[model samples]
Target: MTTQQDIPGRTVYIVSDGTGITAEALARSVLSQFNLTFSRIHIPFVDTLDKVRQAKDQIQAEREKTGQLPIVFSTLVIPELVTELRKADALHLDVIQTFVEPLRAELGISPKEEIGLSHQNMESLEYKKRIEAINFTLEHDDGQSNRNLEDADVILVGVSRSGKTPTSLYLAMQYGLKVANYPLIPEDFERGHMPKALQPYKNKLFGLTIQPERLAEVRNERRPNSRYAALDNCRYEISEAEGMMNLENIRYLSSTSKSIEEIATAILSNLRSY
Candidate 1:
């Protein structure tokens, strides 16, 4: 029943003994639903007593400045470390203990609380799959190597810097997908068709396009004062690329205001349909 007017400015801290990615992601996912201004900070590698004390001191300072309790989201697996962080004057959300205790009771066994074990299991089969996917993604970047296009789970096509590379890498690393990306250039545009190399894997193809102004801005950072980065050229490429995608019945998405995570999820959802 909390309304936007009921929300107030606050501070949020994501504390963890490892990379802090889990704690931060949980905090953002929960906080994104509320309309409030949050000053966020991440305290990572707090695996010792000294680091815990330092983090507690920071929380105290922020509470004094704001005249209210700050909100803390933590994923510390060590009992002693979690105990120390709980002493801070804030609304502490123990992200791990919240579910770990129930699961431990259900299984009637003490949980082996290890830090970063979720991602550090390099010897596991899942880890090997992710590594292989990353290697395949790198080898086929930007249409450099098409010898293995048939092995790709998905092939991304778009004009240069339309988020093809990062999206492809994210798809590979996060989903264990073999992703290959190709950049559509003026030569392809002149031909008025999709790349001939991609015709064989038409079902695996997904296209990305961006606003011409935004595309030009991104390209200008790499090659300033050149025709390749000119706004008119960007506009022309986007127009032709989108037109070709539609005419060829290839699915496409716009990357103008969407995050890589959102774009990748959409691509995966589409892939499921086929």
Candidate 2:
């Protein structure tokens, strides 16, 4: 029964032969399941023997300082480097080899054991599409412009602070979706319709709403005590926005309890359903 109280301040190291992004992401995802607080250290580009020795020294130092075995998540592709790293007195988890060895056995093939292949393809078509989608999403953010509204893969409509911008950007960057987002202002609600720019893209329209309380809290941080951040105003805007979406037969979801990844996945799922 390792409780949160048992580990006062554990050190977790992400060691990689490349940028260390993958190792860190994998480590964080696993660590989130535990309630204990951790001090994370990322040591990247351990491509040389000297760097590997340095990383091993750092891990050993942390273990000595904390009086606890440090946890190391490593994605080092070089065998010699991994062997050297293992000499450190820490719980070492090879992030890549764990899966790679099993897959190799099943497929009867050897791995290239290359470093940084995850992000090596810059001129790839998928990469170019993501870049273009990001540019399109930025250009069309918050009803700024509708120059190519019809080109958007999905157009998000919602009241302010309803998790539109981040979701849009994530959709674009991760899935190569051209996303356009527009705020549902009081004028649109009064006019009993969506924005003029969004009128033609009815098929691509998706809506996000949040609990009035949460919306107010998010807004209050940006503009304290203003009408825009008032709970009552949030309730009014959300009510009107939901009503308009219903009237227009547009699909909508609540962003109150969803992460950006979840929201984007849901949006993509709904889009694919059509």
Candidate 3:
């Protein structure tokens, strides 16, 4: 019955012998289940016994200062370092050991105790795919080129400042999706049709619209007091773009109250449906 109100804050130490990205990600994913606030301290590159000792000292000092056993989530592959860390006065959670031991037993093989092995393989085909997808997304951004719409895994269409650019980049970099994005301008509305380049590849198109107030606010920050950033203009563009999307039967979502991650995830879910 540990309600959020009972704990004002809890300290979490993310200790890793490498970049610490994996440890931090694991800690955050677990912490998100609870509603309590957390103060995170990342201790990366804890590769040596001296470094582990230093990390142990820091964890002990924090526990003494806060009068609470700080939660330590570590991805230390070195047995000696893990042993030293376990002696510290804290709730030590071994991220690698927990999973690796089970895997070793199940597979009957000793796991390689190497650091950064997952990401260190830069010459990997998966890594190359990500790089190529990123490059394709950059080249096709904002309808910059019409030659490769067919090559895009997904194409995002939105009015000005509705988060078309960032979402496309995220899809490309994270999912290895060759994403292209196009802006829906006033001229396109006046023409009363979809862009000729996008007509054939309509299935790949995803529409994004935002609330007028939010769009206006975003535009105003970039170009203040102009007609382009006006509330009326934003409202008009959103309405027209949404109407066109509906008429064309394209899948669309509002980015008004969504973060980039939420928006990207929803887009991916929509893609899977097709």
Candidate 4:
């Protein structure tokens, strides 16, 4: 129960023997429960003694500067590297060994202390599926091409900048789901239907909408002082889009406050329920 008041100069160090993606993700998930802001430093590829020592030195420096122990989240696979990292004057969270040792004991087998194994299986069928899904999603993004619309696992419909593209890509990359997204413009609303390209894939459609104010802010960054970025227009488009989705019986979610991960997970859960 680390509180905001208890943490002075909150800094977090994510150290890993390979890419620090896992460590950083775990750290963020854990830190999210706390009410504190933290400056995150990622020290990746700490596979050797020298690299470990350097990471430790950085952690130590942060602790000295802040007068508070910097929280470290480490996924070092090698025992020696983990040992070295422990020398730093910081709270060390061994992200890997915590689960590894338990699993090793339960299975009664020695763990292969490998580095970057999680992402090294590029030749696996799952990896190939992810690659194909990514390519398919990219090709079908923003209603660009509908050559194989039936092949998509999900079709996203929303007003522009409602978080369609990134959500599509995340579904593809993370779950190997081939996703296609289309923007619901004024023409589609005037026509009183979804885009013709997406009509046949009605069951696959998932809609995303954003709050008018947020949509205006997002659009303004791209096209400042334009009617396209106006709050009134945003409200109109969102209203039309929601109406169309409801008319078509398509499921929809608001992306105004949800992260891309949360939106994708919700979409996947909806898809699974079908």
State TM-scores per candidate.
Answer: 0.80, 0.91, 0.87, 0.86
Alpha-carbon shift of residue 232 in model 3 (angstroms): 2.0
Write one digit per residue (lDDT tens) for candidate 3, span 68-88.
Answer: 788999999978889999888
Model 2 residue pairs with clashes:
none
Ranking by TM-score: 2, 3, 4, 1
| Global lDDT scores for all candidate models | 0.91, 0.91, 0.90, 0.91
Compute the lDDT for candidate 4. 0.91
Question: Which regions of candidate 3 are displaced past 4 Å?
Answer: 1-10, 32-37, 101-110
Model 1: per-residue lDDT, tens digit, 32-135?
98767787899998889899999999998987886778899998898988889888889999999999999999999998877666664878899899999999
TM-score of 2: 0.91
Which pairs in model 1 have colliding backbones?
A: none
Clash numbers, per candidate = 0, 0, 0, 0
RMSD of 4: 3.1
Q: Candidate 2: lDDT over CA atoms?
A: 0.91
1 versus 4: better TM-score goes to: 4
Off by over 4 Å in 2: 1-6, 64-67
Model 2: how far is 270 from its true place, Å? 2.2
- Best candidate (score: TM-score): 2
